[model samples]
Target: MKTIEIKCDGCGADITSTGNCFDYRLALVVETRAVQGPSVTAMAVSLPLDHDHHLCGINCLDQWRDRKRHEAKLWSDWNQQWKEEHATKDPSGRILAWQSPPREILDARRPEFEAAALAAFPMKVTK
Candidate 1:
């Protein structure tokens, strides 16, 4: 639960917050199902995100929380879909590591909408 000011790698826009998950594929693990048989299993990952934290006006804190929630939901959905679509008969692969949003020097986000976002995730300053 770390929040910090960072630039977004994708759009170069200052994002107020971000959520990351470090997912990996297991070694020699195969998942099977009636619908999708012989699927590869991926392991959970702990990714770090450096989101923005600011108090520009009234009730800004609450808004930030909402925003963070949205981010979390987005990540969760993406991961679930990815696992089903990209499973490899087994997690038995070289294990490719990748970041969704990547990294940035500064995060860009609107003051209005951004406030609600920060509230979504808990804050922990690693730096």
Candidate 2:
């Protein structure tokens, strides 16, 4: 017979048969675009493989969860501020125009978005 040991991804600790561990996996869709000299190509969509995370015990799991929540909240606040600052309003104080944020800004917020999604639809496995 052969024995296989799984190590915790978070702390690199050996996971025994009776030890506690957690696993989470998520799938994400990504869009990319290309531009030529005078024309822009349509966006391309790709669904990459799911991201997997493993934790050694309850403490690491709690920390991971809390960090995600915090990141999501931060993203929410920044998004609100950006909208308020960039929104175009009419005389009646109604939003007349809006534009999608720049790619750099969206990239910065990617972690927050991922965190929110992970928290919302967490697929946790315990052993």
Residue by residue across 22-67, what tens digits does model 1's lDDT show? 4221112233434566675547833343433344222334444455
Candidate 2 error regions (>4 Å):
1-50, 108-127
RMSD in angstroms, all models? Answer: 18.6, 10.3
Candidate 2 matches the true fold with a TM-score of 0.45
* Predictions in order: lDDT: 0.42, 0.60
Off by over 4 Å in 1: 1-52, 89-127
Candidate 2 has an lDDT of 0.60
Residue 85 alpha-carbon offset, candidate 1, angstroms: 0.3
